[model samples]
Target chain A: MGDPQLSGEQVRQRALLRFDRVERAVHWLNASLFLILVLTGAALYFTPLIALVGRRRLIEQVHLYVGLALPLPLLLGLAGSWGRGLRRDVGRINRWTEADMRWLRGLVDNAAGRRPSAPRPRLGKFNAGQKLNAAFVAGGGLVMLGTGALLRWYVPFPLSWRAGATFVHNWLAFMFVVVILGHIALALSDREALRSMLGGRISSAWAARHAPAWLEEASDQ
Target chain B: MTEHAGPADELPVRGAGAEQPVPSPAGDGTQEPWSKPIGRRTVLSVLGLGALGTLFGSHLQSGISSALNAVHANGIASLLPGGGQFTIYTVTSGYPAAPADYTLRVGGLVQRPLSLPLAELQALPATRLTRNFQCVTGWEVADVHWVGVRLVDLAAHAGVNPAATAFQFRSFDGIYTESLTIQQAHQTGAIVAYSMLGAPVTREHGGPVRLYVPSMFGYKSIKWLSAIDLVARPQPGYWEQNGYPIDAWISGHPPVQAA
Candidate 1:
């Protein structure tokens, strides 16, 4: 298929097929289940505080079911996207450089709109923000899954295993939720970026502006 | 186009001007017709599943509580022909002391015996973990935070002797005891915890220090850990002597099931 045209500003041609159908499906599926996991996980995580309202059992049960069901969607998502660009995207996000520290410093100054003009780095398909999120979810997801299995099966482990798993599972859950919230906030703020995921394409101009390297790579392809 | 569009501008764009492609039927071609749209139906089904789960979960919790209560009340009378002993203490809560004051002593067999205080312990790098807290008494508490040095960190600090096979944990109570193969103590989540829930350990819970091993039942996690003694021979702990499972990990043995 030829490149799609864009109308609004007449500045950007829309890019296409960055994510294959299977990739998109996995992304959306993971997104949906992750939301559900967050809800159920949050309910479970805050039980000590929530128990004051007297729904500990209810919250806990929901937590267990959600925890049990989480692996299916997660595994499906991982299997679908394993060797695809998504994995590369995850890798890109996790690659830390000195510039990321500058980006973080810019973030603080930029909030008050007094940020200094630093040389903009050529971000690939994923930026530091995206990479960190991906790492947190992927790494945290694996830990949660392994510990969760031991928990549900409750056998084959020594007592120490059970207790330690419980502790890590909870801590990771809270960290994941915070990262997810940040991810959503960024998506909402960047309208074109959000549309790119929804439509599986980004305006060429938008891509060039935000991800010049990715734009060049896509154009070369 | 207006910079700030009102609700009228927010309406779904049906024609050529829409920003994103309308979801295609082929996108979901493999799904059954009934699964189409993922709208109200999916939402309801998810909610319905959650509700059903809640119902079953409550039943499980209640059943578990009743069984544990029976065991707690009657002192394992139903399981062991000879009744087991029960000790009930009032609930007390506070943070545990820092590792500086904490002393992890490993004495008993082999060469290179050691006792390091909290400062010496913290001087080495620390391993922090956060995980769920499940009580065998029938309450499942998730997300209990723990920060401390890992058991491996300690073992590395105090050099393990190859001849040492079993590690016995002695708690402050002087009553509770648990043992692990030297290899098992080196697992990823195994740690000697000085703090829980972001604070120091509390007395009610195992304070001063505790041995946290993730994967086994809570009882296997010895609380109020006073000392860790390595021995060449297997020594039965208080619980083991009392007929509790030496491992005590969750083996899916149904509560109160006939042995």
Candidate 2:
């Protein structure tokens, strides 16, 4: 894939699959649902929205249905070729490496938009921060599913059980909002990264700059 | 449970089994309001509720509260607007018809097995209260006014057996049942209510008579009142059997279900 004579434009012209079709579809679907959930959930949680949000019952019904269906897109993605690939990605996220730790160490400067004069580390398809966010979302989503279900169904759970589940659900919602906002901000900061999610591909040079190690892996595949 | 207690603690607990046919104040520190015949006031309240609930149908809760606020002037019932429609979570759909061949059996571990008709209950001292009914799902119906005889009144009427410490409220629908500890029964706002926001409790709302424990979630308030069986230990309700918390609090995480 490497040619010493190739120009920068030639390198930028080659598009490699950064995110597969199934991955892009599921990711975007989940993103849209997450945004709606945040908006509706916020309206329900805060009191001012009661008067501001018309058709309160209708919105509530929509929130419940949308929340319950949040996992469907991922489930559908798994039914295709993504079942194994998704598991592999989860495993990849769970695994730790020196490069990941190094990326995390530099995350502070990265967040502040400061490109240090020192050499930066090469990363895989996902960096330490992205991996952490993914794991957090996955873990938080499961907790939400469990707690939300318990709250909805009147199974005679003790007040304490209900309270504990409720407490977790509430705090997790705040964290969910914060993390999702950060994710959106980071995505918007990188035009290529955001476009990759929508188009399922990124320019070869763009991949090399952001995820050099993963670019090599992709070329090998 | 958190220290945030509801009105559940103040009022005297009602028990079935008063030796006297008429409700006399029990001497055991429970001073109850005197019983009166269902007067024109009660009928007017029902009519007023019907006007509020039906006239402004979509705005039943808000309208009802506003209507009641005009008469009572108590600001508690008029504070927050009702959020959404009340969702009925029932194992089965069918409920027994009311005031037609209806009788509430106050038996099981009582001195007298009395089959009191609806009129007999209406004759008992009716206490009117407005409460914030919070569901476990975080939805709330504020200023919900209910009128009913106290559980202590019923227990005193039945002369509840001294040996029994708990009462399992059984619903006529057969699908639902719940047990309240003697301690819970003693709390304030524990009553077998028959009226909601002035009107008779609808079949959908657990009618004829239903157990209301303000401290606990709505499910603990057994609808379709049938029988109250007193026992040494609490038998888990239908939902309790289905893995719900036995000691469900509006604010606390109860320990695991007893083995």
Candidate 3:
């Protein structure tokens, strides 16, 4: 069990394996590829959006390569996980609760600089913020895969449907970038969080504060 | 919860027993250890590598374009005809059929509405040309040989009313609609293509008929072509309604020119 007191030294006591080696590898691979796709795809989407990236031909070539390369990491990750990793996360996000709602409200109030009367609720494996991130990543990945396939092929959907697909693909990419930035910022802001990602283990105190329920389950296991 | 100036500025301390062996800074700052400075050598190396990358990437792109153009000049010897590759990804719906029983109707603000069948339309003086097919999403297939009646010829035959300023093209899919200025519709290279690559247009390529506007982006070339309605004013196309540029012009790089 993690020490409950908030202190710099106590941070080291929390320890658990949230993501296995395979999971971490898949995550980083996807992140790197996604970043590349966003960069090249954005260049292709709005040519003048970034001038230094290059001319139309170069940007296009890079975009195509990135697009083509995307499926590789995605397929490999999927094959390795057998779809279980994504399924578990999806299920986790779908089971929202009253505690989750309270946490979200506290987060908003905290953001707005309002001192709420209630103490911050203890989170389980994932807080509302993390749950939301998981949901978007899963949902966004599926949409990206589907639309990219359609666009690559000459298959003509009704113009409206094609347009709709394009809309989802472009906007979702933008939103994903924003969310990923926030995730990275949080990881960097919390030393324990980054350590968990890097070492595949979190301090016992971190597990208790951020995910007490997860810590208990892992201890039992 | 303890009060703080702002969430971002709050010092993030680990719960008891969670802290690792890493030394804590004297100040109560939330900044994580990851923000620590990298060596000057590393920084300089990263900058130098970035510059090198940009230079090589641009040169490589230029080389590719030249090679492509060279192949185009050699004609039959080229891997991609017209110096550009053609990728035909299959659409789920079957290709559109031609000598299509469908009628090409011109109505709305036109002085006289006219409907012509595939045969009668084909009989009219046909215009054929080879131009690049450029998609807004960023692929270009050059020298895409297309054969069909020029839009100008059709307008001439229909005897467009002087007041008609634009035309709306509608496809059988019913959802896709594209509008063009009278001038754009009558441009020298603009055609209502019925054939591609020296063959009758396939349904997958928006065959039966599709608009071919060389100067505009691919979206402007409405496929699965059906009707042309003359309009007194401009109307946005299907893609435009969904956030795509209305006048998607092809620029040298970054397909759509900066506004």
Q: Whose TM-score is greatest here? A: 2
The residue-by-residue lDDT of candidate 1 on B5-69, one tens digit each, is 12112221211111112344655652211111112222234334433433344344335445555
Higher-TM-score candidate of 2 and 3: 2
lDDT of 3 by residue, A1-221 (tens): 33343434644464677766655776787777777787767654442343334243455456656666765654564354464453343334444444566688988888999997466655556677786666456445555655665555423433333434444455456667778899999988998788766778777777767876456555545
User: Order the candidates by lDDT, highest first — what do you get?
Assistant: 2, 3, 1
Worst 10 residues of 1 chain B by lDDT: B82-91
* Candidate 1: segments with Cα more than 4 A from true spot: A1-11, A16-18, A45-83, A87-118, B1-134, B137-259
Please provide TM-scores, in order, for all candidate models, with all chains considered together. Answer: 0.42, 0.49, 0.45
On lDDT, the stronger of 1 and 3 is 3
For residues B58-130, could you state the per-residue lDDT of candidate 2 as single tens digits?
3344454446556555644333233233444444533344557888987778898878787798899987878
Question: How do all the candidates rank in terms of DockQ, highest first?
Answer: 3, 1, 2
Two-way DockQ contest, 1 vs 3, winner: 3
Query: Fraction of reference contacts reproduced per prediction?
Result: 0.01, 0.01, 0.00
What interface Cα RMSD is found for model 3? 16.8
Candidate 2 on A52-102: residue-level lDDT in tens? 553434565677788899988877765555554554444444444445656
